[model samples]
Target: MTGFEDEIRRRLLSAQDTGRIEGLLFHSTAEPIVGRLHGDGLDVLWTARDPWVSAQYIPNAGSEILLARPDDWRLKDRVAPTKHDVLYALACEMSGKECCDVEWDWDGRAKSWRVPDGWPTYGDVVGHIEDHYGYVANSNGVYYVRESAGVVMPADWQIEGQVFVALDDGLHFKDVRRSGEPDLTEREYYDGYAFEQAMAQGYDGVIINDHCQADDYGNVPHLSFGLNAIGREKVEWLALPAVRRHLDPWYSGEAILTPDLDEWLADFEMEAVHAL
Candidate 1:
């Protein structure tokens, strides 16, 4: 066992004697001594063997503290865990820590906590399709065709009608008279359209798959979403419990003796609680 594992084991035993630890959670790579923390006043509520296991069971385990080890996959290659962030955020919230609030940099080697760039945006939905083809506007509706495909203006085209203008490889709609200018009407239109569609379907927000390769390197293709104004309000309302729990002193990292196991742990720890 590494010295860090020994330190964790020692702290677990010390916390057990003082009753500071009520439950424990660890990654599958953790040593047997870590598991020994259980069965003696400390209930081992979870042993995260895989991402799915952690997602399915960790929320149900009301562990007072979490001690996670790095996953085996992360050690082999530094693949980005796109899907795991939500689960980690959920876990952090469950353990009374606010997710993405602080910059968690452990030992200067792990990814820090921040809103991921993978989150979808309006451009990803209606943007151009590389250098070859893009969306163009007409009376019939928008259609994806070869760039500058010699599209003749429709008979009904008017000065006030919507027109497509390409800027930064994104399709932007504008008033026919202002086609030469780049403005934000396209974003407003799409965001409003997405909001309406989601509301009509009784959803709080819209999840979109980004085909534009906008995600961080090594991340798998993942679904991303944005909450409309009303959806954001509803989420904030529902998250009051988590916010309060994060503020509760009882859930603070004071009881976890190892500084590395505290709330300061970075985003990479989501897979394995221990630093690699």
Candidate 2:
């Protein structure tokens, strides 16, 4: 095992109270309290006010924290974990690390890889990680999604769900009436739903009434409903004109209405041509 994996083993083995570590990563710092945004007919909503962070006095989940500062890159506010961090955790696992040097770029020359016979390639492993963790804290209904900025009222918010599928080409909507299930990734499902609805209803995108915003590259497709962890009966969908009536009181109760995306705010005029 490489030095990275050794570090993970060291941390895990040296911990006196593993429970504290879990709570620090999983549990809320304080009760995530918020009041509902009352409107005409809003029902349920989840407003993300902050990025999930570890608290000294909070309960933790079983997740581990990997802090790796990669070379030639640094964030002004925060940094994403690196390959070393991932390997470190894997090395300490019950099965130990597999294909430890499959992706080692020791020669400093790009396009060099070592593939073990009959085993899945390094690319496959990397793809899996990218697909899952890329959108760790997003605005999609499930998982950890944060809201965007400029949000104040209920109407200027969103209800993230599986409505459409955004692929390498463009956006494709799932005809819930026609198609039996959503046909895209979890990240795409929520984004596609918003895109199709906005385009169909003659709106630009989900407007932001909150104080958070970012680009669309970080979002992953929303998985199909009623499968895996997304066991909900149906996907969530909220539109611009219908937000106020559907978001209910976000700050109150157990629900909140955080804007899914701010980059979607790009100007796009929608037109209506009825098929009558």
List model 2 lDDT by residue over 20-129, tens digit each.
21100011122332342211111112222121111111222223232222222222212111344342232222123333343435654323333234333223323333
- lDDT: worst 10-residue window of model 2: 19-28
Q: Best candidate, lDDT-wise?
A: 1
Model 1 TM-score, all chains together: 0.18
TM-score result, candidate 2 = 0.18
Report, for every candidate in turn, its global Cα lDDT versus the true structure.
Answer: 0.28, 0.25
Superposed model 1: Cα runs more than 4 Å off: 1-192, 200-202, 211-220, 237-262, 265-276
Task: Write the residue-wise lDDT of candidate 1 on 79-109 in tens digits.
Answer: 2223324223333333353325334355443
Clashes of each: 5, 46
lDDT of 2 at 133: 38
